[model samples]
Target: MEATLSVIGGRWKGVVLFHLLKGKKRFGELRRHLPNCTQRMLTLQLRELEEDGLVKRTVFPEIPPRVEYELTPFGRSVEPILVGMRDWGEKYKARL
Candidate 1:
């Protein structure tokens, strides 16, 4: 649907969401997961996801400070779709 696409569509957004599906991740961890994505691209995609209300960002006040990203319940609603896509992609690759 156009609505879904508008929120999740993009070169890096889906990938970022996929990683977040595993659990909360710090920014550095996400960067490690998506090494090919430029930091700027990832930051932009995360900002959009946050603005869309599908992702949550938490900032902890500490000596060094901490930040983490996790999916909102609304975001988790897409898990089945994302999981299906992942499964299909695996099968398709195997068939190649």
Candidate 2:
């Protein structure tokens, strides 16, 4: 529904979550994985996901600083949904 779409419907949000499903990743790592997304847009999407309580951000105290993003317990609940979407997409692609 509308609520779910509102949280993950953006062009980059779902992609971001999909990457996070693999494991926690740093800002740079995420940027590399989603090469098409600009840094600013990625940052914005991450903030939104964090605000929605679906993504957790951890900041480490270091000279250069380190930050990592991972899914919250609630967020993990969506894994099956994303996997289903992935499966459906694969099927659709095959049909084509």
Candidate 3:
């Protein structure tokens, strides 16, 4: 659907969600996973995901502060779709 696509349509969004599937991660961890994505772009994509109710961002109060990202229950609903995409990609890769 158009609405659904809009939320996860960007190049980095789906990738971001994919990494979050494993569990919560810090900003640095996400950057390590998506090395090509600029810090600014990653920040923007994460903000959008948070707004869409697919991702949750938490900030801890402490020296240097800690932040983490994890998928919300609503976001977990997309697990099947991501898994399907991964399966399809593998098949397509083999064909090519």
Which one wins on TM-score? 3
TM-score of 3: 0.96
By summed lDDT, the worst window of 10 consecutive residues in model 2 runs over 74-83
Clash totals, every prediction: 0, 0, 0
Q: Mark the 10 consecutive residues where model 1 has the least summed lDDT.
A: 77-86
lDDT of 3 by residue, 1-96 (tens): 898799988799999999999999999999999999999999999999999999999999988999999999999999998888889999999999
Residue 41, candidate 2: Cα error in Å is 0.6
The TM-score values for the models, in the order shown, are 0.92, 0.95, 0.96
lDDT of 1 by residue, 1-96 (tens): 899899988888888889999999999999998999999989999999999998999999986999999999998988888888889999999999
Tell me the deviation in Å of residue 89 in model 1: 1.0
Q: What lDDT does the true structure give each of the candidates?
A: 0.92, 0.94, 0.95
lDDT of 2 at 47: 99
User: Candidate 3 deviates by what RMSD?
Assistant: 0.7
Model 2 residue runs over 4 Å out of place are none
The C-alpha local distance difference test score for the whole of candidate 1 amounts to 0.92
